[model samples]
Target: MTDIDHELEVKAVAALSDGPFKCGTVAIVGRPNVGKSTLLNHILGMKLAITSRKAQTTRHRLLGIHTTDDTQYLFVDTPGFQQKHLNALNKGLNKTVTQVLTEVDVVLFVIEPMKLGDADRKVLQLLSDKTPTILVVNKLDLMGDKGNILPLIQDFDLEFPFSEIVPVSAKKSLNLDELLKSIRTYLPEQEAIYSEDELTDKNERFLAAELVREKIFRLLGDEIPYSVAVEVEKFEVVGKLRRIFCAIIVDKDSQKPMLIGKNGEKLKQISTEARQDMEKLFGGKVYLETWVKVKGGWADDARALKSLGY
Candidate 1:
């Protein structure tokens, strides 16, 4: 066994004493598109996190809870780790990841099948000092052989002492039982941190805003995906229908041209698609409206991110 592996085994065994039989928070950390959100959703058996083909779509730390007769596991989905960007949005994403690490019972170090690099190394370097980390290799379905997976394991081993290394396909629902078992084996048992009825810490308004943001990601593709943010300007329940209004905040006026398209066709399409998703989530009809606004360089400004509750 590598030194890190041995160290992890020892650490996991030791942490068992911190609690009797219940588990609390487990933070999922990895680079973007590594399926951290997918895993959390699959484990929760619902869509608690917004996911798309684009990177950094998840701007905040989303918590999904799993409960059984005997235990509860609160899983946190965080923004993917990336190099520090000049944009305030990117900085806020990085800050969210670091802050989650501080309070987690265990850290799931998610790695995609693609070759691990300096970004992956940076995660190991950060976790080396805090929490007993479980190296969770996600997206196994995309890979064909042990050869593709072996290097990631070795690279991680070379970097830090991870408590456990387990491969899983969050999208395909593969090997998740083993992953959960391994995670639970290490977490100190504690009272359910949240109520049994609560599936996530995010309220209805936050979920509604994210639903709208996910729609934007789906319709706009790459160019506008990173440049946009969604805010719920109005969310009120009138009888059975929920009336909601949100602004699709963009970084430049040029994006408004693209988002609206010819004769407002694109905006109409986005609103239609977003309204359907919101209706399902709200369990009632949703009257949705999208207004476009450009805030130049909001990406680099901390004040902007904080204002958006980043």
Candidate 2:
């Protein structure tokens, strides 16, 4: 071979070896109670997004960042697209999901194992074919038979031409590496968007409020959890300590007693648990103070919802 040919071959091999880095936004979307937040927290390896057993627990667009040696994943965990309850709060949440779908580089359409219904289909309608999407069949731990997954994957393939389909158990942290590898394939070659150590875009105050709200959703009965909203009235940071004051808003005066319990024991339990979580997440001691107040139909009121940061 000529010297010129060998030089050209060496350059080509060098170009292929130095592959461009990948960094882009990925949106995680699905119906309520489909373990979207759980998936995000697992990917992040921390509790950045709040979780609960109740539906509609996530009401905002949360950004969780996971950076590896070769790629950085900017995951936007969106609220579950609401179909039934068209209240002011839910409408806002649905808007968040649609807005995120358009802006993301890749879309992770999360759903439960073998249970795709009208609500899941509704979310699928929002996805654009232009954007690379992956069907993440979460909760594989709950599935009894592993053989059923193959047919389930085929069934989902008929609905949309997904770039790739990955079944993951977010709760058990199974097949996450495979899921990340599939996601990295579609990420555009670019520089990192966030710092390597940064975990999320949300501030500590927002996380504190979410922790308190999560406890409420987990501890309380179904009726009261939806009506409640938490606001950090004051967040004072002094060196290694953080002092937080939160207001727990209720829709009616009758509901206040239920949250407060017989002698404020219920609220105390909620505060203690929330504070403990805050310490672990924040890496500092947190003194959390909470109180209940009546908001009188804030969930339906547009003005109230706006004030509450919905």
Candidate 3:
């Protein structure tokens, strides 16, 4: 076996020990766009979540594993909490954050450094059971005055007695190592949750779909990306080549033209970029096909969301 593989075997053996050192789930919870997904990606040293300035980009609880010589952390990246309308998608999205409470050893409550609103207060009230919540103040890099964040911590410190308050810049990778060290301190003794080589619970099809959705989020503005869903209909891996067929589902028929653009130029660009990234991900040649379809208010339909594996 290779040196790295041998190390994994040793760690796997060490994990079988009776006492001390373990693996557990650390759920990242926060309001929309607080960099919860970004922070998880940073901790795992890979882009496992689709991140953007847009709200509700993460609709599911994604598990990213970080295994070390002594500990393994299964970081759960949850959907951002937001206002839910009558729409089923919104309701499902709202439930995603709330559902995370039941299945975690530690809850990393991410809040922006700028302000703590009523939503933050509500989260504090909901997590009143003292579930080992860590109040994480993210986006420190965006603040002009670093010292300004300290006061917010002091102010809210009385409102909610958090297990630990950590200030970090998820985008800039600031204080992430310290965060990991802190997380490891809380986990209980257990065997590794997954194989050491496994980085995420999401399959290749899911990642492939996410790549397209992320590209749309990056390129398209307004409500276009939010009302969008990418599904990989076909994925064939033949030796060094990968063939992928994906569909972009939109709520309105009018949105199709915007995604396709004039003479399919826009769609081509999106595919080219996504395919290049996919090739890098798989380390092989990729043949990608993209098609846009209108699902007629599919975003509001619970059945649609369920079918999409949400």
Candidate 4:
């Protein structure tokens, strides 16, 4: 927030007849495993998006609203565009990516420094011509040469005329202030779209389910995480305490034991971590109950996928 930028923000608000607020939708788009959800979580200063090392952790479009004193940014975190391992689930996730691109006011195309691949190019192709995209070079802390960043930016600059280029490290919380400012500059002069205190469009139930799924992704191995889906069977708010009952859906019977672990230890650990996260997110006491259920071939079944909220 420079002095000049602050002054411009003030003038844009009072100078306009509507109000002195700026609000717009921002879409964070990138290929699978490119840290799109991580960047969104970092920008909002909270863990609204569920991120894991495994790709396709985010299956649905999530709107995380960050309201500053002067502007409100509705950040849409979409599932990564899948190019490999085509299936019904992947198809739905890929459809989510393209659908969100058409609805946002601006786009943040996050990518690694020099690891651009075919999937990255395919995501770039999905961007609409009318929208101004900021090419965010994420994971800057992983790079050894700071000087080579310019050439990397130029390489992408030739592919598409980006509005601006910002290099940031989402994991280390580096250079994100600049990224936020860059995103705000593209916002239109209008009143806030959502209430100032609202953080996301999703309810607490959705977040609890996603949190459970995140732990499953983080703790599990191999293809087990992909076969897992979380459903909140019950969400009860009693006074200041919240009691949530959740079910972890697995495609096969063999995968059930992996989530439950020996003596149900893995499920216990997952519940404890998820409850702690829910406590932090809700600012209240959370009592979470979790169990594993076998929903064979839910990923491939169309009706089962719909029931699982795919």
Ranking by lDDT: 2, 4, 3, 1
lDDT of 2 by residue, 115-199 (tens): 7899899899999999999999999988989999888888888999999998899999999999999999999987666666789
RMSD of 3: 3.1
- In the range 114-199, model 3's lDDT, one tens digit per residue, is 67888777666656455788888888788888878778888877877788888899989999988887887788887665767789
lDDT of each: 0.79, 0.89, 0.82, 0.86
lDDT of 1 by residue, 181-268 (tens): 8888767755555555578878878888898788778787775747688888888889998888888888887789888888999888
Candidate 1 Cα deviation (angstroms), residue 14: 23
Instruction: Give the CA lDDT, 0 to 100, for residue 82 in model 2.
Output: 87
lDDT winner? 2
lDDT computed for candidate 1 = 0.79
**Candidate 4 weakest ten by summed lDDT:** 10-19
Where does model 3 exceed 4 Å of error? 1-19, 84-86, 223-225
Over 4 Å off in model 4, which ranges? Answer: 1-20, 223-225
TM-score of 4: 0.92
For candidate 2, the per-residue lDDT at 310 reads: 87
lDDT of 4 at 135: 93
RMSD of each: 8.0, 6.9, 3.1, 5.0
Model 3 residue 155 CA deviation in Å:
1.0
